[model samples]
Target: MEQLFSKALSVSVRCRDSEERKSTIRVTIDLQLSPSAVHKRNLHVRLTDDKDPYFLFTLSISEEDFQSLKAQQGLLIDFGSFPQKFIELLELCHSEQEAESPRFLLQLCSQGPTPEGPSSLSVVETNAFKHLNHLSLRLSPGSDREVKDYLASCLARLKEEREALELRLKRTEEDLSRQLSCTQQTLCEKSKELEKLRSEWTSQTSSLSSRYSDELQSEREKALELQRRLQEQADQLRQELESAHRSSSQQLRSRVGELEVSCRELTERKYKNESAIRDLRMKLVAAEEEGQRSKQQVLSLRRDNSLLDSQVHEKERALSQLQMRAAVLEQEIKDKELLMSRTKDVLEATQQQKVSLEENAVGKDAQIKKLEATVKSLSEELLKANNIIQKLQTEVKSLVGKIKVKNTVTVSQEKVLQETTEKLQSAEKELHSSRQQLGTKEQQMCALKEQLESTVQKLNESREVLKTNENVISWLNKQLNERQMTRATAPEPAAAAAAATSGAKSPLYPLGRATLPPVGGALSSPADLRPTTQLDVAALDSKYFERVDSIPIYGLTSHLPKEIPRPAKASLPSAYFSA
Candidate 1:
């Protein structure tokens, strides 16, 4: 019995349901011989077929129970014969608590056999099995060879599963490395495309800037030419106006002087004719008194002849002499009357000539007043035109400053062009209004027709120049719009390239949707685009054109150049005559 308990024993715990189907739980039990005590021994039981080798349990059997188990080892020992002892031993060694209550059968077979068979089978009674359903223990193996063979097979299976897992891990790593290389190649290609786009953009910007600069230079030259021509025309008009005014004034002065001299002569002749008429009236009155006295003398002579008839021959000779004297007096009286009528006709003729001369002087004075009023109006218009020009120049300067500040922003450029167009339109309206005023002034100035005609021709030339300037401005606007359209279209490919390259490392491709620095550090600064220079040229051209528009249409005396003398205001003819 001691030798039997000391050796390693094969233990199989089988569970059977109500239908008697067995699921075996195999383990090994080691029962070592106790030298200190014969009554007790430690029974060690460990699972063999399970993956966990440490699944084990230990049980201690008392001296009486061990002796009974030893006494029944070679015989058919039934569990029902010693139900309490077996149940206690099984409870101590049962490691799986999850198994349900089922019928248990414990069978112990020894290596040495009886005459009946090589090993004896032990079974538990039905009544004992009902209470011992948690465990079923069977010790069947007699040697170590079977346990060694089972352990070897488990070791080989574990080694094969480990190798299979290692191979799968290696394959997954290779797939990841291939994907990484492919991503790197895609990033490199995207970077190359971005660089190409940047180069194209740079070239396009440079070409557009050069074209814009050339156009601006040509327009500036045209504006300067127009300004010089307008200045020359203005100078010529001023000279002509001055000459006409001087000559007209001198002629008016001379004509007024002649009229004054004639008036003085007429007045003097009137006084002389009155004196001659007075002398003739006195002569006629004296002749009439003499005739009355001659009549009285004849009456006295006739009375004396009647009284003294004796001396009749002597008295008749004296009476004949007196009658002849009376006939001579009558002839003299007729001649005096004819002389008085001739004097009266001469006085009437002198008075009529004086009246006609005074009417001519009044007409001349009125004409001088009209001429002076027209000159004043023309001067005022010129002053107003000058003021408008100054205002336009200031506006242009401010716009230029704005362009300089916001040179990179295209919207500001558009706004500047719009403002310029509006200012030009306003200037055109002012020019039209000024032309109407000039037309009215020309009609009033009939004396200066040739001068007005020359001025009108100059105005027409200015209008043509303005039209050309407008055309240039429109062309510039179209170019600007085209440039803006190009700039708008230029960024799409770059953005796409940036988005494509975003997946690469940040140090390799630094571009983003918001900020795209030039690839490979090629561009030094923003100024290389030349937008500022182009805007400057545009501003200068606009300023020059505005200056050309500023020239006064009606050349004012106050605004005349230093070389040209201004005409003096004409004075009334009456005042000149009076002075």
Candidate 2:
């Protein structure tokens, strides 16, 4: 069956009069079977060309015209045959002379205003009002009081919206200011850090230059000392050679004089006596033979002296070579000393870096341990929360099962579940936050581990360098001992060799002490040779404890519910007691 219907369109109307530029008026239309029925249906058709700020007017038409217009879809009505007000509205909406677009819109609404009150109507009825009614217009304009009330309500709503927008704008401004201040503080801190780094760099450069100059001066001094010692040794050797030459010449002169005297005596004896010629001749022959023997002995002595002179010349050449070798060894020792000094400086720098890294590691370990404790606590809380949730669920199920028998208990259980749910939510939030914190700390630990590995690599490199230097120094010491043995006589050379060994031991003592601690737990140094500082042991112990404390373990019963429910009353006790 076809159903009776009404339709209405509410439109904000703008009209330009001769004096006024533009005026806004609210217009509503209703189309139905009768005027009385339109009022009864609260179908007010409000339209006005009045000068007031607000107005309401009603227009009602017959059912025949409504049906005819409804069949035509009502979008393009024949305003040529309609009322004057309707024609005026259409003209105002489609005026060609108006430069500006229409400032009004049409809203299709289901219900219209009535004399008694506002009434709700079906969409079919409203559509009928718009589409199929005859032109029998009956208008009821709203009183000035009603119009003033509507305007007042609209103004109040606008004021409230304006205040709310202002409040939001102020909050945004505050947030921006807070962020700006935070950025400014961070920038200032960065600038300060930059300046501090620049100053440290300048100081380091200056110290490096001074150390180089000092090393150069020490090397020069060692060279000059070596040269002076070589010169003294050369002068003493030349003097010893000259003295030996003078003594040999004197001995040869004395022997020659003695031989001349012997020859003279023999000549005198031969000339003085001829009477005892035969016996004297025999004695003289014996004396001449003895003299010849003595001369031969003297010649042998001269040959031995010449051999000694050759031996002395060879010793002098050996001494000169030894002196040259000693000079070379001294130069090498100086170089080794310089290298050792540089190694010591590097070792000290590495030690400081190691100490700092250890300290940072210790701090991180402590933080990790603290986070672990917090995580443990959070886990406990979560377990407790979960246990509570389980209890609540069981209790709620029990309560729901007996809800018809015990509404009061059900109500109480509901409240308990609500509280438990809130607590569970809070616990979960804490767990999430703890998980985030753990992730961040783990990242820090990984970064620290990387830093520690890098430091260990640097330390290993330094240790190898120091070890190589020590070996070179020891070799140089051995070379020095060899040179000393060649240059100095037997007892003196022995003493010098002992002294060289002692000198070699001295530098190694400090080098071993300095390099040992940084290479802890590594077999770089023998157990006996490692530094025996109390502080180092204490620091190691502390680091070990920190590591051990960072990790945590849980027990199976840690999350168990604290309370157990009691057994219910006996089922057959009442009947048994009665029997």
Best by TM-score: 2
Model 1: per-residue Cα lDDT over 1-579, one tens digit each: 222222122233322322222323443444545666433454534333364432223233444444456454642443233334543444433433234532334333334332111332234423442533333333333234545555666678778888998898899889889999999999999999999999999999999998899899999999999999999999999999999999999999999999999999999999999999899989989988998899889888887876677567568877887888788889889988998999899889989988997898899889979988987977787677768777777887877777765444557677877887788788878777877978888787874766667656655655554565666556545544443344445545754454335424342322221121232333244323332212333222232244322333366536533332122224322210121
Q: Residues 1-579, candidate 2, lDDT per residue (tens digit)?
A: 111222223332222222212334444344333345322232235444335545445444444334454455553553323444453544444342243433322322223332222321111212323532222233444567866775686679789999999999999999999999999999999999999999999999999998899899999999999999999999999999999999999999999999999999988887766657877889999999999999999999999999999999999999999999999999999999999999999999999999999989988998999999989967876786678668767866665676655443567767766776786677678767866887899899998778767655644544454454456456444534443344344334655565456446653332112122232243232232222211122212121122111111124125423321222223322211131
lDDT of candidate 1 at residue 182, scale 0 to 100: 96
For model 2, what is the C-alpha lDDT against the true structure? Answer: 0.55
- Cα deviation at 104, candidate 2, in Å, is 89
lDDT of each: 0.55, 0.55
Looking at model 1, the pairs that clash are 39-63
Candidate 1 overall lDDT versus native? 0.55
